[model samples]
Target: MNFNIEPISTQIEEALQQKIDTKTKPLGSLGKLETIALKIGKIQDTLSPALNKPAILVCAADHGITQEGISPFPQEVTFQMVMNFLGGGAAINVFTQQNNIELVLADTGVNFDFEKHPSLLDYKIAKGTKNFASEAAMTIAQCEQAMQNGAAITEKLHANGTNIIGFGEMGIGNTTAAAALLTAYTNIDAKDAAGAGTGLDEKGIAHKAEVIAKAIAKQGIPNSPLEILATYGGFEIATICGAMLKAAELKMIVMVDGFIVTAAFLAASKINVTIADYALFCHKSNEKGHALMLDHLNAEPILDLGMRLGEGTGNAVAYPVIKSAVQFLNNMSSFADAGVATEK
Candidate 1:
């Protein structure tokens, strides 16, 4: 469980800024792109930073909360969507293919078993988490296993020279778990954290909120990240937390997806605050609690396409923008190199 993530040093910030400012453009005109370039440079600890073998890891699982009828989609949909991801039919598949980002799928804890597939990593920790309404979502052992598996996956990718990763998840009723985690981490009311996930209607969302509230009351407020995750997190969430921490430890660019992925990062940040240093929030999801969650982290997302669908689609969609940021920093000519007159 020891991530060993270290804070990114600020020693290079000034130098990075100088290099960016010398670009043949009005200072700060590039806005957030400039910020992203600086961040990538800081992460790589170099003036010239490159994204290598960028890939998106979509971890799918089932939630015990799904049995409580939180989502309009059936629990079977979780496994079905995993199949879609494998079949290259999901939105994430389309976007990743469109952008040429490698797609990695993991069965962290889906309810169904599958035949061996080359693209799917079989790291199933359990069929699914236990119902938090009646018991802890996952035993401590399961939580640790899921996290370790996630970290191991990232380590393998890093070994393969993959320096940038996007984290995403699939789980029926996962929003309930995310709401519970958000409430625990930010003290946001369960009602506010609850959202219309997977086409939940108003009544379903209200019921979801009540379910989360009861789970919180039963579990009491968790004192630590591990405790919170064990109490309310889905297998995919725990795994993403581990992946994110390991990515930071390896100084990889972590492109975080929407609400559920962000919730995992919230827990990871609590465990090791430096994880945020390696993360680039890809977009502000249209999910109700997402904006609040982003505000909680003081994160500014690069896109606002009103996207709420998961499966790492947001990360894949935003990859070009992120790449552009790094490209302009490393490839754009400086005023001196371009023979452009500096403002007097």
Candidate 2:
């Protein structure tokens, strides 16, 4: 599917900056909050921009590369975690509840057959993706179908008055899939792209890196961004990528979570560079490749609390701060309104 994600217009930048500067604070005392304020203002094309009906799209899937023993956790954990999410016992659920943000979960391609759950969107493409080490993870048709499903989900969220959303994932060995995509897109070596997913020791991390190397060698190089995603991307990743692009196309604020989510954004940004204009990097993942991806994208994440959980927990945790940015932008007093002296 094609997305016409235009670059955020700079028509309102000066007005937004002026509005922010006239607030009752130092020239830049809000620090990153000020930057966020300006970004949101421009994204909305209004100085009084408001974030409404915020939601987090949590996608679940399983990776066949778990066959390589790259991750410490078994593939069953992916299915189990989806059930945990449904039961509202997962970290993503807790934070979303605490922050009063909606958490939307989808079964992208988990291996297990889930009985009908009211809250879970059944967008499963297949049982799960094929192992990339031996062959392509998905056919182009399957990849595109996942992408369309994600886009449709995001469009529904938009239709429901949701203007901002976060992307998240739950798939075993997805870090390996993310690492493989990182190497392909940024041309970074696999050693730097691999990381300890699900608490791998140093030795396991080394083995994971080797697996990345072998996969890259086997796949050769991707001819296109979609090729890269189909070659090594997870169903969750491709779905998230589609949602992100559609969000940008709709001019909705996109909250990008940690490494896997960022990898999806990376591919989406590759597809449409302007998607970065509407994204907020929610947090810095503890994974090495996450930092490298952030650097490559030139994005400054909102939080860096050493978080590595992949269920969009970073998005839920950092969401309050984003709300504060918008709240201050709309409600904070100016020096004149407060009858206060300006900094001299």
Candidate 3:
């Protein structure tokens, strides 16, 4: 999929930083908040940036790789958890509601048919992706369709006045897919990228690693990121990847959730490297390989609460801090405005 994502113009960085440094608080006292404010300023290309209609798009799907017994949770949980999200019972639901962020659920490719929910977007791509361990997860056409669906939904949200979008996902056996995609994007070893997804034990982690390795060997990664995504990414991941690309193109501040979402970010960045200009690495997941992946991008997460729940909880939980960043930038008085003298 093609996106005209441009780099955030840095022409105003000096002025933005000056505005931040002149705050009544000691220079750099706000630390990352200062950095976040400057980024928002550069992204909107304005000194006064306001977050409007913040939202989290949670894409739910299932993975046929569960056939290999990769996750402790049954594949049916994908359907169940999407139900929880719709019924306002999931952790993501709780966090988004508490933070007053709009929760947008999409049935990207769950195996089971869902009853029509007013909130869930119907963009299911087939029943779900095929078994990547034994075959391609999705055809190139399916992958393209998934990305198009994602970009379309994001555009709709943008049209609706949403300017801050975060991505979340629910899918059994997707961490393995993420591991495979991580390896494809960064050449990280499967053994290292593999993790204890859904509470996999030491033995299960090793087995998951083996399956990732086998899948890579059997279906050799293609040259293009899209082909690699089709070979290994789940419907939800490709959807989120597409959404992120569009969010950057629309100049929205993108909040990246846990490991799985970050893998999608990796794909979006590979497609358009400038997309990183609009992203805030929301949190560092406690899951194995996530830290390594974040380090690969030199990303300093806004929070590290040892969370690996994956359903965009990180974004919802950390958004207040993001708002705080913007709040201080907009509300805090400058030294001169406060009539406070600084030492020479």
RMSD values for the candidates in order, in angstroms, are 0.9, 0.9, 0.8
Using Cα atoms with residue i matched to residue i, what is each candidate's TM-score against the true structure? 0.98, 0.99, 0.99
Task: Give Cα distance to truth, residue 45, candidate 1, Å.
Answer: 0.8
On the 0 to 100 scale, the lDDT of residue 72 in model 3 is 96
Badly placed stretches (over 4 Å) of model 3 are none
Weakest lDDT window of 10 consecutive positions for candidate 3: 113-122
Task: Encode model 3's per-residue lDDT on 84-114: one tens digit a residue.
Answer: 8888999998999899999999999999988
Candidate 2 lDDT, 200-310, residue by residue in tens? 999999999998899889888878899889999999999999999999999999999999999999999888899999999999999989999999999999999999988
Superposed by TM-score, candidate 1 places the C-alpha of residue 258 at a distance from the truth, in angstroms, of 0.3
Error of 1 at 161 (Å): 0.3
